[model samples]
Target: MELRDISRRVGIAAGVVTVLALAAPYAVLSGGSYASQLADYYASGVVGGAGIALFALLSVVVVASVERGNLDPGTLAGAAVVLGVATTLSAAAWATAIEPSPMFRDNLWLVWHARVVVALSVLIPVAAAAYARELLA
Candidate 1:
């Protein structure tokens, strides 16, 4: 396959990985009920993990449908960069803006959640950079 094709595939792969990180076991709040977990998550002032995941998922679809279909390398790279930066900011906000209530802070799960988001945030940029470098070359 061409280098452009490889870059496109890699960008999609990175985006999928980011979505998974956003959705995976952010926290298992007390009572072990899904509702309770959701409630606890939303109680935080910031957007929850699910929201971040959904946004990232939509971004991936846009990349696949719009950029990939047209084989527009420059547009694809630009989209990747914009999406990556937005995801990074949103993830960072979600991780940091979470209320420091006992419920949130007391759980080790919250720390893990932050770590996952932070990691994904980093991955987005790297993926974007890779795509941009290939397109620009």
Candidate 2:
């Protein structure tokens, strides 16, 4: 396959993974009742949950823009990168803000979940940018 095609596939895969990560707790929560609760807690808020959804949506937009071969792929990718960075910063801030709370401090699982979400936020834009580079190349 061409490098651009491969990059596109990888970008799509990354988007899928991000969506799954946002949906299921098995990846971060290790599967249990508490897993759902922690997942809900992190994903329920506007800054936390809405940010994740926006990130995932941007990831898909990057891939779709490339596939459509109409809009400027680089611009879309660049936007994703900017948004991803913003999301990461917000998530980190959110985590720090909540970390001192009794619920966050008491639950190690919540800490792990926050870290995973932040990591995924970092990855989504990276994958998008990589695909854009390959497309431009």
Question: So what's the TM-score on candidate 2?
Answer: 0.65
Model 2 Cα shift for residue 9 (angstroms): 2.8
- Model 1: pairs clashing at backbone N, Cα or C within 3 Å: none
Error of 1 at 94 (Å): 0.5
The residue-by-residue lDDT of candidate 2 on 19-110, one tens digit each, is 56655544544555556555556554447665766666676666667667587767776776675566567656655544233445555555
What global local distance difference test value does model 1 have? 0.64
- Cα displacement (angstroms), candidate 2, residue 31, comes to 15
What is residue 122's positional error in candidate 2, in angstroms?
1.8
lDDT of 1 by residue, 83-115 (tens): 777777777777776654455545667566766
TM-score each candidate: 0.70, 0.65
Q: Lowest-scoring 10 consecutive residues by lDDT in candidate 1?
A: 25-34
